[model samples]
Target: MSQPQADEGIQTSIDELGLPLSETTFVVLDLETTGTSATDARITEIGAVRVRGGETVDEFTTLVNPGIAIPATVTLLTGITQSMVATAPPVEEVLPDLLEYLRRDPGTALVAHNASFDTGFLKAACERHGHPWPAPPVVDTLRLARAVLGRGETRNHKLGTLAAFFGTPVTPNHRALDDARATVDVLHGLVERLGPMGVHSLEELRSVTKPPTKQQIAKRHLAEGVPEAPGVYVFTDANGADLYVGKSKNLRHRVRTYFTAAENRQRIREMARVVEGVTPIVCATELEASVRELRLIAERKPPYNRRSRHPERVHWVKLTTEAFPRLSVVRSVKDDGAPYLGPYTGLKEADRAREALLAAFPLRQCTHTFDPPRRTVEPCVLAQLGRCGAPCDGTESRADYTAHADAAREAMTGDPAAVVDLHTARIRKMSAQLRYEEAAALRDRLAAFLRGAGRSQRLTALAVLPQVIATRPGALGWETGVVRHGRLAASAVLRPGTDPAAFLASLEATAEHVEPGPGPVPRATAAEGELVLDWLTDPATRLVRIEGEWTCPLRSAEAHAEMTHWAHGRAPAQ
Candidate 1:
């Protein structure tokens, strides 16, 4: 079957037409039912009035016959008895005309006191008659009343009580048409109270609240000059101190949301009262915005930004250069000539990576600072169990122990093939002996080593570059940036009509002013470098220009097809 025509369809139009609430059309409806439960009872009468421009456009009222007997309690409450509806048309017979009446205006908003009750019975009736139930947007007067009038202003926000309080022209007396007409008056009264807030649009009316506290309403002007572009924004107090720093794809929407009652964060709600103004720094891409946000939070030490303010606290897995070389988790990557594997999330992950590396190579597992040729020391239990080289005692030669230490360093920072092959051979031997638990443990270690080594290699590769231009697809056009050492030096958007050569010239000038970093590498720099690597790895990203080569000289885990086969227990490639 074909879809119904737009004008004749049951769908309600929500287009605002740039019109105020007074000019918008609303259909106030009411139903007289046999009982409260829609499933157990039936609608005995339907009453509706369509109001537009503060005047009635149309009114519809009809008696509907329920095939079942009406309960006596319903007759007393609603005055709609079986005798009154005995000769009326059944609900199935009246559905077509009712839908047509409701859809007379394509852009109508359906209204009722407790909307769910009437709309529920109407929806069931339409579904029963095989009519396409176009789900129209609803405006519940009960919610509107509670939101607009405080408890002291009205006795209780019931239909009859509200109508009496407003002195509506029509009084509701357990009758459908009278109740609907009274509801129309109540709607207009509520909207009249909302006019001062400049909430003229239907969308605004649907979300309107009682006049907000003076604090929340006064801060609305802070968002007036914010742009509809990707950027980082700062909220500052009256004392010129940073309260919060945030980033968003749309600066205007994100900043404005903070000044509304809808903001549930107690801290932000308190911040709104003190926020004097917003400062927006537009960026070429959201990636740049995120990097800028991290930098601003770290520098300004904003009280509201608790997460990324301490990137320096992240831990790294470091290999010590002592005589008995072993792994240790350190807070910073110093200039000490030891190979570093992370900037991992925390000490726990760094420890796991250290364990994986130790599983493959028998490096000294002791905590002691070794004095070579000291015969007073005994070998630790790990040395007797073959988990470490017995360098504590004189059993392992210096040359032999140095070679093993170099192999461990090579696996983490150089080739990685030595550790990869060792774990592979161990896993295979365990499987052959039917030692499944041992084999599984070896495979997990290999996976952890691969994950850490791959990330470290990629980050280290990007962190050494002097300057490069990276581009990714965006909604407006190509989002491009010039990155120096791992930091975003300058950024630009290359739209369709933009001159590519001119864009590069401006970017190069900006890059020149930025002291090109082969700067001290910190955990913060590594975290930002991950963002750059993500853009570079995308197949769609085009490297428009480069001053230095981007290379991962060491073999990446992604290069080995057989590694995945062995990891997943699949047959090796032919």
Candidate 2:
């Protein structure tokens, strides 16, 4: 089997998330402080024991002059008086050595009985004295003991109670070093208890105390087969029906997160309860994973996926193919050859685009279909208002009505200068007259039209292309994709040191054959086409070959992006 390559800037290995407890290093530490509140406390002593595989490797102990009087209550508790630390180094001097000890072993997790109390004082000291704190992974034995041991097994989860229950050789004294040593043994005891519960890895150990739902725990096995790589994952039910579809750069890590308490989304938790299996489809790059995820969600319409499941529901402003062409808001694009202005996600935006086109050109806005030469019926109030050419009556000739339809089509498909210029002039006139609200409304309508027009133009540009081959550098080799008609036809990773030309030839031969369809994005959904466009326009992507022109209209949405920003009551980009 071919090993999956890591996409650039992503870690595609499970090592970090799957490091076994036996192979993990832990620095069990305790701090003696003057007060309980971390913000008000000052550390007087620090004690730590570095251990791996349940064996002690080294120890760190220190006394620091806290530069503040040690409270009598604290002194009574820990027994280290001010005079005891009087000749000792100040906290500023002690922090460097302590930080060094923590940094000596990379990937070492910190362990403590009441970890927050200990870590808080140390972090406060490091911050006060201007020493950078090494924020290591922390394991709180107090929380772990509470999570693992029953009340019948232990009276309390205190350090002394746990140490006595575990029968550790070292008992917790008031002093820091003895307490740290006792905590280490307690940690080992907790680990032993967790082992049978399947908490074997350090990552699991960290989140085990919080505990996932029983359903999540039972479904964890679903993540076992997912490799750590950029991919799309589908969670399916017992009947093999898709429940949810997701994409991730690290499939193993992301899938495992769902079975941990870290994944707190309530909907996902419910989905986890019914998830019978996970299907992982590895890809050559993150872009391909994203595209595939979009395609799968659209195809399966999974219950757990809220977005992209209803691409067919996307609204479009279509110029109806009738005797008198009028703008119509539609749910789906068909191969009827009528020009469409959008895959608009909202009906209101499509209406606004339709209104903007009608405002610019005197096209009929009514749903009435005319059979020909002209009707003798009375025109609606819109004709008297001059918003319509009154094609329903004999007032507007067929040739003149056809001219308006042609201009509207040009604005929707080729160039939007007429619509944009008219809206701009209207907005300027309204602004000059201090009718700002009406002007803003017109601006919104104009922006909606431009947005749809720009998107339609961009997608049409890519959809017309017969083929486009692009590549970008990946961690293991060259990440490449063959796109035809705005859809991903094939994708692969050319291993490093391989001949690029030969790989390209092989990829082109095996690429999926896509027959061009009608509308903006023929072979794929608009969302998928947009994703492909994003990948193609990425600065890192290089065009290896192109079968036809791969360019947007000279005056598409991008050209007026700043103008739209200004229209939306914001300053244009500098």
Candidate 3:
């Protein structure tokens, strides 16, 4: 047996989606067929190379019997004559081996010069043979070449042209294996070209060819100076007013994507056409970038950003301060000590949470404003149906209603044990009865309840913590922040060898410039609270100092198997 040929300069790792270039496995492939049209043609030969972290790992090359005459023109074009494939295995045999080789690793990405052409033939072959096809992530070097190369760089985008342009050691000889080897070189070359532009992951590489509109292409230079690091970016019009604000781990790549077809939103395209320049604020971490993006959108109220533009729009499920105390979805959180649960994304989610709480607790359902001394009142339907205590009709005592309200408050702000227990039993009963739709509805309510209650408990815990400093390691240095009463007070980048004492002193100085208020809650907006929660929960971040205890007495009601069974509507694991 002969050893497979190896390609060079392919090993380097840049991680995205937790899988880096160095760790990824690629299968570069090519096919020679009986004709140009995949619909009419049959594959005569298949060639491929498997590479991992820049080094060639394995090679596959085989001639396939097409069970059709080799046209003279096709033979002349590919140099694969009828005699060459006379004794070779059929496509059915060759396809299984090719698929098996590709499946040797989980992170394998299929690379081809014109991927659709080759992939089309392979898919047809699989279907004809009744064999299952694995549709792995495909990277088309032809599309990538167009995206990376300028018009003057290549005469035309062709496999041989690219092979010659990149100076690959092996030239394509119209043979399957030789062309595939050349394509492997081209793939690596294009990936190297894309690295600086922040094309580091499989997802980015696959979507690189989404061509920008003509208007967007002209304004592409606006992203020229954007850094390739986690940060928030603002797009501004000619008048220097902000048009749109976004955050990304790779600022340059993300900003560039706005001009490309990858950004499909019409509003974004309109914003892109008017964008004159970009302003980026480099942050210590992605969490910081996300928080800054939310705050910027809220402050600027840019027309392009729909979400986070109006933090006040997010509804909260609040227990009213009225004597009856009904559960209602309200927009604002008051300074008064009433139990509030949410920052829910919309009215629907808040209503779902409210319904779940109502199902579990018997609180007043009427929307009446009552005075202490009233005449005979007509009871509402809920009161007549025994769902309520008939507080409106004055049949229920104020003390009895108060007790029910307290239970609801506990379910909303503290332990959701009452709500969780109720839903779990209902879900189990429905599941046993095979009432799938009802079970699903009950499951959704339970999920909403737990989500709201958990968020409230988390916010309450963080709000009570007066002062703390959190730190995480980043690309440049340590990312440090001083959070007072759960609101960011100060943030700084601490370079190594710089004295910790000096950094802390400067951080304290910056803290004086910090905005006041932990607010009435731990976070003013849902986004802000989410950022704090992410920072606090990150296993990598260390708490350097604290003025008060950071703790929560309440726990999420999701410890039960019911949630696990019904989440995503999947059947429970045996």
> In candidate 1, how many Å is residue 196 off?
22
Best-fitting candidate, scored by lDDT: 2
Per-residue lDDT of candidate 2, residues 240-336 (tens digit): 9999999988898889878765565579999987899999999888878989999899888999988789888889999988988888898878888
Displacement of residue 194 (Cα, Å) in model 2 is 21
Clashing pairs in 1: none
Residues 390-438 of candidate 1 have per-residue lDDT tens digits of 8777788878889888888887776777767777887778767767566
Query: Which residue ranges in model 1 land beyond 4 Å of their true spot?
Result: 1-218, 370-376, 414-448, 473-478, 495-499, 512-524, 553-574
* Per-model C-alpha RMSD: 18.8, 16.4, 14.8
lDDT of 3 by residue, 402-449 (tens): 999998987776667787778778888876776756775786676666
Candidate 3 local lDDT, residue 459: 74
Cα lDDT, all candidates: 0.74, 0.82, 0.76
lDDT value, residue 181 of candidate 3: 94
Backbone clashes in candidate 1 total: 0
Candidate 2 lowest-lDDT run of ten: 565-574
Judge candidate 3 against the unseen true structure and give its global Cα lDDT, from 0 to 1.
Answer: 0.76
Off by over 4 Å in 3: 1-209, 227-230, 249-270, 284-286, 374-376, 512-523, 558-574
